[model samples]
Target: MSPRKPDADVPPGLLLVDKAPGMTSHDVVARARRVLSVRKVGHAGTLDPMATGLLILGVGAATRLLGLVGGHDKTYEATIRLGQTTVTDDREGETLTTTSAAGIDDDAVRAALAAQTGPLQQVPSSVSAVKVAGRRSYDRVRAGETVELAPRSVTVHRLEVRGITRPTPDLVDVDVTVDCTAGTYIRAIARDAGAALGVGGHLTALRRTASGPFDVTRAAPVEEAAAALAAGGGPGVLPLTEAAATVFPVRAVSTEEATALAYGQRITATGIAGPHAAVDPAGRLVALVEDAGATARVAVGFPPAS
Candidate 1:
């Protein structure tokens, strides 16, 4: 049976979970619902059971904000172990093969990583949640069906090499900071990087450094997140308005503009062009809008606005 609710006194919002290794992202969400005692819960993105890092969770009405969360860029710090291949594209898989990447120099390795540092196409690891023909890739893998996910374009703003360690003549660890679009798979980066170096590689450690404005600094471990809620503690998981404010291009809305949006009407273009975040005089975020049809129309809304 699942655990009972405990944080009955806490207000609902997002929880930045610094997920520990070995627990599935779903496990974290389940634990969080019990810890926060919220009737509604959801996770913004899925992290593999073996990987750990910042996992954003929505409590109560914040669940509606998941799609919004998806729009923001994400960052990660990961360690890829070179000279080996894995069925899972990660260390959790069976060791498929091994080779000595001993001759690969730091310059060549950096060049390989740098080659992937900009906007490029990326393929997800086979053992992933991506769906094909309306079925999850992992589900197919579980049922003994061969799965191959096609490459998709993803923007990689940065791929800073943090370090590299050679534990053995064959085993090497490369650390990287990834600032990229939402769908880029770090595991794929590892796989491709290894392929480039003439040696296979797989991810051994993963830590999401940031998602939009939320960083590791805002994240807490499962226990700590629970304790904070249980103690009648912590800040409102950045209300919808505030959370939206962090990413959207800012716009100021007049009373007329606010009224139009409040009544589900689009406002006229006041020579202000944007796919912008419109905030009321009260600091409540009103809508995300695009300058279309000669008016700044609401592309998305945030009412009960923060």
Candidate 2:
């Protein structure tokens, strides 16, 4: 595919991608950049190559909104294998240790998972993308450096066990669905669960089910998205006006107000605790506004009429 020259006319919006397994999150962004012909494509969250499911990308000016998008809670379905631990806390990593899981029972598994639910501290995997001293932990690991990440608070709102299977006499696979706040790691959950049960554990599979307002059911396949855009059916980007309206509190403004706000003017606040979408009477988003006492000021403005 030919790279699209940077154009000011491309519409800004989000793309919900059903990422295929074995492709890194950056791979999808690179493909979207080529397919949509837009240079600015950013994703809200990262999914490891071994995982599949919903991945949200922002195109063009929507890249400015990715930080907000990334703040939303996420849901995942994963299989945790008890009996072995890995360097990465997932199947893709090298196995570091193994222990018999034959003596573990369902009741104990449920109890351990239940204990992990709600607010608690979690240590990310050693090979996670988290930065330490301005460098990625994974990069540090690959360079043969020892890395220890500090624990941070995370909330796992709900954890439901879907099923359990004994693939072998000494190995048990627990399938679970998790709803968690942003930054929660499913791999870490598997690792911790196994440690709690005195058996080493690692993630075998992971599939994200949802991220805030976006769900896997509504996501288009990455290949389909690329094909549709390349065929000129559309950029396949979700409309920005609808996206902003749905994701944030809305404040209707007149064309005059819209124009003023787009030019960095502040309008009267309506007591809405903002980051509210200030929309024109026609329902197009003019700016993201926040209330400050008597007025609302633009947090981000889409100029030239998006």
Candidate 3:
């Protein structure tokens, strides 16, 4: 059969992509736009060019949901190399210093990493995507400007040391799985841990395993998804209603309530929780709503696609 042509009928939805290394989050979105034939593609969170794994993308009107999705907790599998410090705090950066880490025992390594858990005021890597003085910190760094970013509050729910290996007498590599609130920097964790151990450190490898309720296991490789779309198959998108239900608490509403929400009017409070997905009898997502006194107000409304 011939491939499906891009048309207005493409549904608003979400795509779970298993991103490959060397592609930025924006690159994935651009590929999605070309294959899905819609210009409304947007990503929930960013994965660095050197990191790979689950990347959530919103399509069509679902772009409005990205903000909420980006704030959720995430999980990563990473390898931290003790004894090496780098400009970017990752292997992609130029080496700054190297110290002998052979003397650091597994117990000491665990202790240092344990200190990184719970609440933290982490200073992001100098090359992070964080904005500084209205420009990206990375951009400033590439321009030879020394940028000092203030520490930001973040939570590391868990840090499991998967294994510890000595690749050389001078270096130690620690494999770990991290569950952290949004904005927690794994690179910073490595840097801080190495600092505590009296050695330097940097991230060598990283991959996102999960984000919020979404897991990498459900993701399709970007190439595979795009190829399917180009071949006139389904874009493999999770419909907006299903996606919303997965991300937020569901509040089933009557047809009348759906109409009111679609019309920008408030409805009776669900009381289930604020930021719940309000769905109609037919299961179409009406809006993401929050309770205000006796009524629920739309945080983000999804009017029926015209």
- Greater lDDT among 1 and 3 belongs to 3
Instruction: Rate residue 23 of model 1 by lDDT.
Output: 96
Model 2 backbone overlap count: 0
How do the residues 138-217 of candidate 2 rate in per-residue lDDT, one tens digit apiece?
A: 99999999999999999999999999999999999999999999999999999999999999899999999999988888
lDDT of 3 by residue, 75-117 (tens): 9999999999999999999999989998999999999999999
User: What's each prediction's TM-score?
Assistant: 0.83, 0.94, 0.93
Q: Of the pair 1 and 2, which is ahead by TM-score?
A: 2
Report the candidate with higher lDDT, 1 versus 2.
2
User: Please, what are the lDDT tens digits per residue for candidate 1 over residues 1-306?
Assistant: 998645354544567789999899888888887766765778887888887788888765557667778667889899989899998889899999898999988998899999988888898988899999999898999899998889999999999999999989878899998999898899999999999998988999888878888887877887677557556455324554566566666788997788788777888764666567788898777778888767877777666522
Q: What is the lDDT of residue 301 in candidate 3?
A: 90
**Order of candidate numbers by lDDT, starting with the best:** 3, 2, 1
- RMSD (Å) per prediction: 3.7, 2.5, 3.5
* Candidate 1: C-alpha RMSD after superposition: 3.7
> Which candidate number maximizes TM-score?
2
